[model samples]
Target: MRAAVFDRFGPPEVLHVVHVPDPRPGPGEVRVRVLAAGVQPFDVAVRAGEMPWAKIQFPQTLGQEYAGLIDAVGEGVDDFVPGDPVLGSTMLNGAAELLCVAAENVVRKPAALDFPTAAALVAASQTASGSLLELGVGEGDVLLMHAAAGSVGTVATQLARRAGATVIGTASLRNHDRLRRQGAIPVTYGQDLIQDVRDLGLQPTAALDAAGGEAIAQSVELGIPLDRIGTIVDDKAAADHGTRVVRAGRDPKRLAAVIDLAARGEVVIPVQPFPLDEIVEAHRTVESRHSDGKVVLLIAS
Candidate 1:
């Protein structure tokens, strides 16, 4: 099996694909023939050695989310069978040709959603859903989202809208129309962010920060309470400003709910795709932090 790996992390160019021994599922696990994977900021940080907590070894595999078809199931696994279409979270092995994850963690993929899009939704969905829930966002609340054009931002905006909250998101001027179409009021980033939202006459009762920088401080200046301000990208900022650090843990059920809505076409995710062989480019794309929706890698069968 071939997989993306890095011996000594430094840059996207350091990533490359190499053939490794095929893996078999252990008890209570299922082995999947990966069809697509999502490259995330976390993967970029890991590759650059920015995340000291990540357990990296020489030639370590990269990736956290994938969509694939089940090829085998180990003992005690009864939820999935060969040919079952699924998508889920994995640990640093998602960019490979095959993955073995516990059957309990797998989220069944609807036939309506393609493999790459399903892969894109795995990590972002859980994070968005959990963050909204923790922040108590609901009807009658106006939410201010920093980096609203991002993957998690896109998903969060749609979900918050459905929950009856109005969304005001920060992004580049080019993404303003895209945000408006997603039911959000678009605001640009930087010094005017607070003034931009203020001009809308909508008071932000809650906020989600997926983009770092002064998002936390800006959210504070916008009059959103420290408790209602959540930062997924910067714990330091959250702590410094007395804001909530949204620790949305991985949850298959949370992922399934949003995915089901996506399958029914109630929510939308635009995809930026690259082939698996272009792993270096995919990593660079994620690192660029400019692509809307999710950056996906199409893993060929």
Candidate 2:
């Protein structure tokens, strides 16, 4: 099987497509013929060695979320069968034609969604859901979300709105209109964020920090109880300040909830899928940090 392999990571240019041995599922695992692999900030971080835990056995295949068809199951796995479509999240080994993961990690894909979109929904959406859920966000809560146009931000806004929370989202001016369309009150990133929220007459009852700038950290520091704040990035800093980390690949129950939202059409993943040969370009596109939505890799059958 051919996989994109990198020895020492630096830039996207370091990635190369190489033919090596095909991986098989061990006990309690399943081998998936990957149809689409979702690339997130984490994927880019792994490629650049920014994420400390993304390192595993190298030469590494760096991807965390995928949607594919089951090809084979390990001895103890009975939850899935060959030909079934599944979507899942993992910490590593996802950027390839096939993946071997615990059967528990793979959830049956919604019949209504396509593979690439399914792949895009899990990691980002789940992280969003977990943070909101942990903060106990519900009806009548006014929520503040930093980086409101990001993949997780988009989903978080939608989900919070669906739950009847009034959402104020912070993004660049160019993204404010779309954020409003998604049911959020938009504030430009560099604007007086707190004063802007106050201008809307919405006192924020909770906040999710997806952007991780000093501004966000200072906002939490000024008043928002450290316990009420959660960040999907900057885990170390968040911890240092008593803010929570919305750790991805750490909660399976949250993942199931996210999958349910996608099935219900409460979450949307807008993206384009590139094949393995173009994997280098895919990584580059994500690294550029200008993608409005996800950029995924479609591992050819």
Candidate 3:
């Protein structure tokens, strides 16, 4: 199997695709023939050695979310058979021609969505869904989302609106129209972010910060309750403001629910794709933090 790996932690140039021995499924696991893989900011962190807790070895694979078909099932894995289409999260081996994941962690991919689209939703869906649930965002509540043009923010904004909440999304002026289409009142993010929201006559009852660097503090300045303000990034700022650090850990059930919504045309995630051979370019795009949508690797047919 061919996988993208970095021999040493450094820049995106460190990434390269190499062929390795195929991995077979173990008990309670399923081997997938990867069709697409999502490149996330977290993957960039892992590749750059910025995430201390992530165990890295020389020539380590770098990817977290993938969509593919089950090519083999280990003994005791009866739910998924050969040729079952699935998508799910993995630790660091998603950017490969084949990967083995725990059967329980895999979610059935809906036929309504394509492989790249399914892969795009894996991390964003879980993160956005979990963040909203933790912040208790619901009907009548005004939810403030930072980085409204980002992958996680895009999903969070749409989900909050679906729950009957009024959403105020922070983004650059260029994304304002896009946010409006997502059912959010878009406001520019900057020193006057609070005033911007106030000018719109919206009071934020809860906040979700997908963008770091002062997002948590700005939410606090809006007078939103500390507990109601949640952040998936910037743990230090979250601590400083005494706000909730919504871990929004990976959950297959949560991912599946969002996937179902996407299949029904209720949730949409734009995807920017690069071929697997151009792994370095894909990494650079995610590192730039300016991608208009989720960045994904087209691993196979």
Candidate 4:
């Protein structure tokens, strides 16, 4: 198997592809031939040694979300057979040509959804859906979202609107139109974010922060209840503001629901594709934080 690994925690430059022995599935697990993997800010943080708990060893494998075909099923796995198309969440092993994941964690990929897009949706969809649920975003609520053009924000915006909430999303001016297309009222994220949302005559009842730094404070300034203010990116800010830090743990059921919506063209995650060997470039792109889409590594397809 070929996988993306970092020899040290420093920069995207540390990421490189290396050949390793193919992994065989253990009991209740399935081996997958990975077709694509999603690059995330989590991967960036791990690479840069910013995540204190990751405790990376030298040559650590990276990536969490993957889309692929089942190559083999291990003992006790009954739902998936060889050649089953699937997407799922894994830890530190998704960006590879072959990896093993728990069969229970795997979700079937719809025929209508391609591998790159399916990989793109895995983390963002789980995060977005769970965040909204935790924040109690629902009908008639006015929701404020930071970093609205990014992956999780993009999914969150669409999901909020579908739940009958009015969404006010913060993004760069250039991505304002993109937010608008997703049915969110767009405001530029900055010192004036509060005023910008106010000018649109919407009082935010809930807030989700995918961008860190002052987001929780700004959500507080907007008079959104602290309980309704959630931050996926800024745990410190959430702590400081006494707001919710939405870990929004991975749920395959939630991911599958969103995948079904995406298959029906009801939701879309824009993806920037890179070849598997371009792991360094993919990490660099995710680290930059300017792309209005998920960065995905196309491993074999």
Stretches of candidate 2 exceeding 4 Å from the true structure: 236-241
lDDT of 2 at 47: 75
Query: Candidate 2's residue-wise lDDT over 1-301, tens digit each?
Result: 8788788778988888898798889999999998888887777787788877654567888888989999999999888999999988876677788889898867888788888888888787778877788888899988888888888898899989999999889888888888988899999776476666666875777888888766456557447676777787777778678777766444667776777777777777668678888988988888776776788888888
In model 4, the runs with Cα more than 4 Å from the true position are: none
| Model 2 residue 191 distance off true place after TM-score fit, in angstroms | 4.5
Query: Which has the higher lDDT value, candidate number 2 or candidate number 3?
Result: 3
What ranges in model 1 sit over 4 Å off?
none
| TM-scores for every predicted model | 0.99, 0.92, 0.98, 0.98
What tens-digit string does per-residue lDDT give for candidate 1 at 92-112?
999999999999999999999
lDDT of 3 by residue, 142-163 (tens): 9999998899999999999999
Q: How far is candidate 2 from the true structure (C-alpha RMSD, Å)?
A: 2.0
Model 3 stretches with alpha carbons more than 4 Å out: none
TM-score of candidate 1 to 2 decimals: 0.99
Worst 10 residues of 1 by lDDT: 284-293
